[model samples]
Target chain A: MARLSLNQKTTDRWSVAEAVAGCVRAGLPSIGLWREPVQAIGVPTAARLVADAGLRVSSLCRGGFLTAADPARRRRALDDNRRAVDEAAELGAACLVMVVGGLPEGSRDLAGARERMAEGIAELAPYAAGRGVRLALEPMHPIFCADRGVLSTLGQALDLAERFPAEQVGVVVDTFHVWWDPDVLGQIRRARGRVASFQVCDWITPLPPDALLSRGMMGDGHIDFPLLRRAVEQAGYAGDIEVEIFNAEVWAADPDAVVATLARRYVTHVLPD
Target chain B: MARLSLNQKTTDRWSVAEAVAGCVRAGLPSIGLWREPVQAIGVPTAARLVADAGLRVSSLCRGGFLTAADPARRRRALDDNRRAVDEAAELGAACLVMVVGGLPEGSRDLAGARERMAEGIAELAPYAAGRGVRLALEPMHPIFCADRGVLSTLGQALDLAERFPAEQVGVVVDTFHVWWDPDVLGQIRRARGRVASFQVCDWITPLPPDALLSRGMMGDGHIDFPLLRRAVEQAGYAGDIEVEIFNAEVWAADPDAVVATLARRYVTHVLPD
Candidate 1:
């Protein structure tokens, strides 16, 4: 329970103040922040609210979309990520989770897209390190590889992360995104020092029409959460395990009830035996 | 065009006879068959029909759902796969493509499920080899890794295939599945003479409600088909290249028009330049 964090997206309707109040009310030790909600209240106000609540910020929602082929769009993406980094630093986030963009419009060259993503990271890692923030590269499920994250596997993320200092660039191990990987255990082991954030969510089938909201509550799906939890723990990721579900049903549920359900599941499904 | 094969599912409305005639009509050199339609018309009649039309059988649709945990269910799966191998031999298919089953009902033990799949392949490989039918394991995309295939990458399939003699077990390189793989080109290079079938289909986004029917026609999605075709060709596989799309729109279209569209896409997107 001490390691549990409520990712704000898990309770989509909650504002920063509402989420901070909700986390404190739920007896949660931490909360993961999204940039939009933080920016709405202004970063200083959001940071002060969490600090007053004595809640740690697990991670910033995202900071990468570096696959833009156009020079102006790519420049905007990098500038936006730099702003995201500033927000993470102000919020005292553990890291800024990176969802590297997929192929550009009208493009089929995956290798080229991935190369651009690497370059984006190389350009950002030093700046992030200077700000005392780590850029956490997330390897989304391959289902999202064409439009979301070009980094489709932890191994691929590591290939890029390994190029930078471990303090500057790391990786996120989101259960829903990586549970299907045959080599996940090995990759998690390899991620040792570079595992910036460990997120928990279940992979549900009959994935909604919008695949983006396909995650389910932990016990309701087929993932053996304890197995992955144990692996991440063994990898020395002594950090908050954020419950970050994106399902529409979850978003529609009463925010307090969603927090209660996830906290209980976190204990039953994710805590080490 | 000489190497192009129409996988029967690409024209779901066609009977075995109609599919064979359609191939001849479309000037396709080969046809990939599904066991259900082949069994529906009786394997002998279907085999004779295709042989009579002088259309080579590229590969049999499937065989390995061998991850059953129950003793009776496991035995039945092996027996069914054995029958599938017999059908492939009777149809003179170059190989029998295997989509290994996912976790058993109410199960979360992925490692155990994968081990069972390996054992199933081991048990069936000898019988398949004796029948002169190679078992071509198809590594589905990770999206299907939970419900459809435990084998989620060409490298994982090859790890299983390489344990058996090359003639006894080979692998299917379906572009739709492996195209998202960062290591696909390297795995294709590793496949070399063990590549049994090369399948092509584009991957479109906003995947239809049923993820199973999500594949798009080539040139409609983001896959670089010619790149994949060239990789398979360089791997020393001169086998029929099967176009195995499963889009609902494709299934509902006029079979001949669908064939014509695929033929054009094949030459434009898949053929060596």
Candidate 2:
């Protein structure tokens, strides 16, 4: 229970204040914050609200979209990421999760897009390190490779992360995005000492019309949560395990109820025996 | 142009008779046949239709889904696959594409599901070989790993295919599925003789509400068709290149127009210099 964090996205309708209150009421020790909610409430206010509720910010989601072809857009993205690092620092987040952007518009060069992402991370890693924020590269599902994140496997993310210092850059093991990788267990082992965060959600099939919201509540889908948790724990990631489902149905539920459901599932499916 | 094969699903609305006629009208030398359509028109009749038109059946559009948990259901799947093999042999298809099933219902055991798929394939491979049909494992994009095919990369497919004789087991290199893989080029090289088929289809973003229909016409999406075609050719595959798109908009268009569009795109985006 101590390591269970309810990512705000599991109950996306909840305001920052509401999320903090819900976490405390649900007896959760931490919460994963999204930038939009924190920004809406003012970063300081949001940070204070969570602290006052005795909740730690497990992670800040997110700080990357580094694959824009236009030079101006790419520069703006880098500038924005630096600001995100500052916010993550202010919020005392364990890491700044990155959903690196996909291919530049009208570009068929996947390799080129990946190169740009590496350059973006190289430029931002030092800035993030200076702020005591880790850049957590999240390898989203391959479905999102073209439009959301070119980094589509834990191995790919780790390859990029390994280029930077362990304290400065790391990888996010999000179940929904990577549960299908046959090499995930090996990748988790390889990611030892550099796993920035471990997120739990389930893979539900017949993905909703909008694939992004296809993430399911832990027990509602077919992921072997315990297996992933054990692998991450074995990899030395003894940090918060965030429940970050992006399902429309879950989001429509009451925030408190959502938190309660997440806690129950976390105990049943994710916690180490 | 001689190697271009119109996969029936690209104009899904077209019946077997219509598809055969359409291919002949477009001066296409081959067509990729789906089991449902062939079964509808009767396999022998459908085979005769293609043969009479001097059109080759580039490949049969499937025969696997071998990941059922129920013993009875699993047996049924194998039986169906045997029938698919007979049809492929009857049609003189270069290979029978396999879209292996995802995890069984009420199961979160991906590894186990994959094992079952392997067992099923091992059993079917001999039967396929006996019938003079090659079993072509098509690794659908990982997004479909949970519900469609556990074989999600060409490397994974080749790993399984390598376990059997090349004539008994092979792999389908579909651009839409394997384009995102960083190791795709290397995998294609490894596939060489076991490269049963080379499929072409562009990957469009903002995937339609239904992700399955998100495949775009060549040149309409982000895939560099020539790059992939070159890799496949370099791998020593000199067989027909099948255009297998699953798009609602494309299907809604007239079949002749769709074939014309596919041919135009094939020349502009897929054909080598």
Candidate 3:
């Protein structure tokens, strides 16, 4: 319970202030934020709101989508990521989660997309580090590989992260994305000091029409959460374990009820020890 | 064109006889068979139909689902796989593509399920080898890890395959499955002598509601088909390139048109050289 955090996505209807208030009501120690909501109230006010509520900001939702082949779009993406880094710094977020972009429109060049992703990261890592924000690369599921993320494995995330200092570039171990990797336990072990964030969510089946919202609550799916939790703990990730889910039903539910449910699930399914 | 083989699922509307006749009409030298339709007419007759058409059986549709934890259910799964092996042998399939089962109805023990999958393969591999049929373990896309194939990566499939004699057990490299793997090229290189089957299909986005039927035609999606095709070719897989798609739209279309479109896509998208 002490280490539990409520990621904003879990209570999708909540704004920055609303999520912070919900976290405080739930007695959660922290909250993970998204760029849009934080920027909505402006980062300074959002930062002071969380600080006043006595909550830690676990992470900033995202900052990557750098796989543009077009030079103008690529430059704009890098600039946007730099702004994201500044936002993370202002919010005092632990890290900026990076959901590296998928293939460019009408493009079949995956290798090129991936190479551009790496280059974007390389360009952003130093800027992020200078702003006191770590870039946490989120290795999304293979299902999202065609449209959302090119980094499909934790090992692949680590490959890019390893190019920079651990404090500058790290990987986010989101269970929903990585629970199916055969070498996940090994990859978690390899993550070691570079694990910037640990997110808990279940990978549910009979996926919704929109696959992006497919993440289920921990107890409702097939993931061995305790096994992964133990592995992450053993890998030396002692930070807040954020419960992040992106399900339409969850989004439609009462934000407070969503937080309460995730809080309970975090105890029973994520932190049994 | 010489290596092109129309997987039965690609032409979903076609019966075994119809698919074989379609293959003959398309001037395709081979056809991949599925158990349901083959068993509809029985194996012996199905075998003769293809033989009579002078079409080689590239590989049988499947022969796995071996991850049951219950002893009785496990035994049944192994027996079903053995029958599939015999059918593959009778049809003279190049190999038996195995879509290994997912988690049991209510179980979360992926490691346990994987162990049982290996044990089942160990039990069936020798029987398959004796019948001159190789068990080509198909590492399905991670999207299907919970409900379909627990084997999610080609490297993971090879890990299971290398534990057995290559003649008894090998792997199926489906482009749609392994395309997202970061280590896929290296894994293919590692799969040199053990490549039993090479399946090709495009992975499209805004995946259909079923998710299972999300695969698109060759040029209809974002996959770099030529890249994967070249990787398999360099892996020394001199086998039939079976185009296996599972889209509802493709299924509803004319089977002959599907075959003709795939034939053109195979040349332009798959084997540009």
Best by lDDT: 1
Q: Tell me which of candidates 1 and 2 scores higher on TM-score.
A: 1
DockQ metric, candidate 2: 0.76
lDDT of 3 by residue, B148-235 (tens): 9999999999999999988888999989889888888999999998999988888887777888988888888888888887888898
Q: Regarding DockQ, does 1 or 2 come out ahead?
A: 1
lDDT of each: 0.93, 0.91, 0.91
Number of the top-ranking candidate, with TM-score as the measure: 1
**What's the TM for model 1?**
0.99
Poorest 10 consecutive residues of model 2 chain B by lDDT?
B204-213
Q: How big is the positional error of residue A107 in model 3, measured in Å on the Cα after superposition? A: 1.7
lDDT of 1 by residue, B104-148 (tens): 888999999999999999999999989999999999998887788
Pairs of residues at least 3 apart in sequence or in different chains that clash in candidate 3? none
Model 2, A24-52: lDDT tens digits are 88899999999998999899999899889
DockQ, every prediction: 0.82, 0.76, 0.86
The regions of model 2 sitting more than 4 angstroms off are none
Residue pairs with backbone overlap in model 2 = none
RMSD of 1: 0.8
Model 3: residue A98 alpha-carbon error in angstroms: 1.0
RMSD of 2: 1.4
* Residues forming the 10-long window of minimal summed lDDT in candidate 1 chain B: B203-212
